[model samples]
Target: MTATTVDMEVRGPWSLATGRAFWEGFAPAALPAARGDDLTTVLLVEADWSRAEASVAQDGGTAAITVDGDGDLDAAAAQVARFLALDVDATFWPAVGERDPVIAEVQAGLPGLRPCGFHSPYEAAAWAVLSQRIRIPQAATLRSQLTDRHGDRGAFPAPAVLRGLELDLPGRKAEYLRAVADAALDGLLDGLALRSVPPEEAIRLVQQVKGIGPFAAELVVVRGANAPDAVPHHERRLDDEITARYGDGATVDSVSAAWRPFRTWAAVHLRAAREGRLHEFG
Candidate 1:
C-alpha cells in the first residue's frame, strides 16, 4: 500500500509541540507517546486506520501530514486538520485577551497555543464517560488497561475491539463505551460531520447516546469539536480562577462574558492556574 502525504494550509498560531503538550500533559497514556516536533497518532479514515503524522513548517502556516497506509488520504488530511484545530483564527485572540488582564497574560505566554481535539468525536465522547467520577490518573489508568487488553500496538482500541469487551468498569460507563463504539462504527459520530455543527446541537446530538449527560455532552463538544464557547459548568476552583481572572470578587458568568467565543480556552487557562502550572506556559 502506498503512503499518502498532504501539505495542509492552516490559519492562526499553531505549534506542534504546544498541541502535543496540551494532549499528553494530563494523560500521557491516552493513545501513544505524542512527542517531539511531529505529533503522531492513529487515525481512522473511511474504513481503515493509520498512523498519522503532522508537523509544522518553518513558516508556521502549514502542516505536512503523512499517513502510512492505503487509507483514504483525503480523509486522513481532514482528520489531521480537525485534530490540530487548524481552522481557528487566533488573529483576534490578542484583542480578546485585552479585555481581561489574566487572559491577556495567558495568551501572551502561550503564544502558539491551539486546542487539540481527540482523534474523533466518538473517541472523545467515550473518553468523557470513562473519565467521569474518577481522578485524571485513575481514568488514564483505566484507559491504559482497556487499550492494553484490546488495543493494537501503541493505538487505542478500535471500535470493533471494544464492542466485545465487557470490562469491569461501572455499568453505565462500560455500556456508554460500547454504545459510542457502535456509533463510531456506524458513522453517526464521525468527526467531520459533528465538528461542523453548532456546539449546542452537537451537545444535544451526543446526549442522545446512552449515559451521556449535559456535562459529558458539553465536554465532548469542547474536546471533540473545539467549541470555543463551551464552558465546563459546575467546575470547582472558580474563586481562585475568578481572582486569577478578575481579582477577588468577579463571578464566572460576569467575567466570562467578556471571553465569548474563546471561553473554552479560558477554561483551560483556569484549570492550568488551579493546578499551579500556569508557569509552564508563562
Candidate 2:
C-alpha cells in the first residue's frame, strides 16, 4: 500500500533533537525507539482496529508524518501528534521559564524539550500491569517477548489481540493485563477521550481497572495522555528535584504554582536533568 504522508504545524518551540533524545533514553522498553533521524513506530488506529506504521520527523515548523498501513490515516496522524506532544499549543511555554529561574536553567539546557508519552493509554496501562513489583529491565523483557510473539512488526498487540492470550507470567500479571485490555476494548482507555477530561478525572477513570494504583493511574493520565499542565502528585523524583532547587521547605504544590500551564514540561525537564538524559544538565 502507498504510504500516507502529512505535515502538521507545531504550535510552540520544538526541536526534533530533544524529542529524539527523550525517545532514545526515557523508558526505552516502554516507548518507541528513536532510529536515525526519524522516530518510527506502529500505531493502532482505534477507529477501525487496524495497524499503521508511522515515521515522524521534524520539518521546520511542522512535523512530517509518513504512514504505511491499511487503517485510518487521519487517525494515525492524530495519534502521532499526541504521542509526540505536537498536539499541544505551547507558544507561551518559554514565559513560564522566565518567571522561574530554576525552570529557566533547565530550559536553557534542554531547549524545545516536549513531554513524549506512550503511544496510547492502552499501552501505558499494559505497561503498568507488566511492570508491577518488578524492575524495569525485567518488565521490558516480558514486554518484548509479548510483542515479538504477538505484535505486528514492533507494535504492541491490540487489545483484542491481547485479551484472549493466556500465558505464564509472574503473579496475576496476565490477569491484570487482560483486564487492561478489556478496558481498552471498552473505549475506557481511548487516548482522545482520556485527554479530553481533566487529568485528575482521567486518573480516577484508569484506576478503576484492576491492578492499577494511584501511581499507575498518574502514568496513564500524565504520560499516557500527555497532559501538558497535569501536576504529578506522586513523582518522588520531582519532589526531590523540587527540594534540591528550592530548599528543604519547597514542595511540589508550593513551587508548581509558578509553573502554571506548563507544569508537566517543567517537571520533565527537572527529571531529565537529574537522569543526565539531556546534553547539558547543569
Candidate 3:
C-alpha cells in the first residue's frame, strides 16, 4: 500500500482533547515516527476515527499523522477532519447544575471534551460490552488481551480479522467475546450504519449482544460512536467525584447542568483528573 499524506486541521474544542488522549488509550502500537523536532507520527486505526497518535513535531502548530498500509488514507483523513468539526450543542451535555460544588469544580477544570468519531459501531459496541462491570484499567487490559488474541497484528485489527478469529476469553469475559464475535461473523454488525444511525437505534442494536446493557451500549455510542447525547451511567468514580463535590444526592443531571452545551467537556475534565493532568482546581 502506498502511503498518502493527508494534511488537514481539526476544529472544535473536543478535537484537541481527542488528539491528546484517545489514541493513547485505544491504539498503543501505532506509534508515529518522529520527524525533526516538531513533527511526530500520528497513527490512525483502520476504519476508525475515535483514536489517533500524537507524534510531536518541531514546528509546534501542526501535527502530522501517517496512515500507512491502510486503504484510502486521503478519504480516511477527510472523514476524520469532518468528525472533528462536528458541532455539539447544550442538549447533548446532560444537565449538571444544582448538583454540587465538586461536580462544578471538575467541570470547570477541563473545558474541552467531545465525542470520538468512530466509523465502526460494532467494534465500539464490542468494546463497550467487554468493558461492562469492570474498572477502566481492567477493561483496558481486557481489550488489549482481546486484541492480542483476536485482533490483527498491525495498528488495529481489521474487521475481516475480527470476523475470522475464534476468541478465547477466560472466565466471564469469554462469554462476552463470544457474543460479540458471533455478531461480527454473522454480518449483523453494521459498520456503516453505526456511523450514521440514530443514537437510540444504535444503542438498541449494540445492546443486543450478550453482556452489553444500557450503560455499556451508551458508552460505545457516546465515546466510540460519537453520539453527543451519550452519558456514562455506571461509572462509580465519576459518581464519587460528583458526591465528594456535591454530596450523596448528586445526580448526573444536576452535576452536568453547568456544562449545558459542553457536557463532554465535563467528562474530559474528569478523565484528566484521573490522569493527574491538572494538579489542583483552577
Ranking by lDDT: 2, 1, 3
lDDT of each: 0.67, 0.83, 0.50
**Candidate 3 per-residue C-alpha lDDT over 13-57 given as tens digits, one digit per residue, 9 for 90 to 100:** 333543434433433122233323332333334344223433221
- Write down the TM-score of every candidate: 0.84, 0.94, 0.65
Candidate 2 worst ten-residue window by lDDT: 26-35
Give the Cα-based TM-score of candidate 3 against the true structure: 0.65
Off by over 4 Å in 1: 28-36, 45-58, 237-240, 276-282
70 Cα displacement, candidate 3 (Å)? 4.0
Worst 10 residues of 3 by lDDT: 54-63
lDDT for each residue of candidate 1 in 19-74, tens digit (9 for 90 to 100): 66666564623334544567777654534554444333424687777766555666
Tens digits of per-residue lDDT for model 2 on 200-266?
8988999999999999998888778788888889888778888988999998889888898988889
**Judged by lDDT, which candidate is best?**
2
Candidates arranged by TM-score, highest first: 2, 1, 3
Best by TM-score: 2
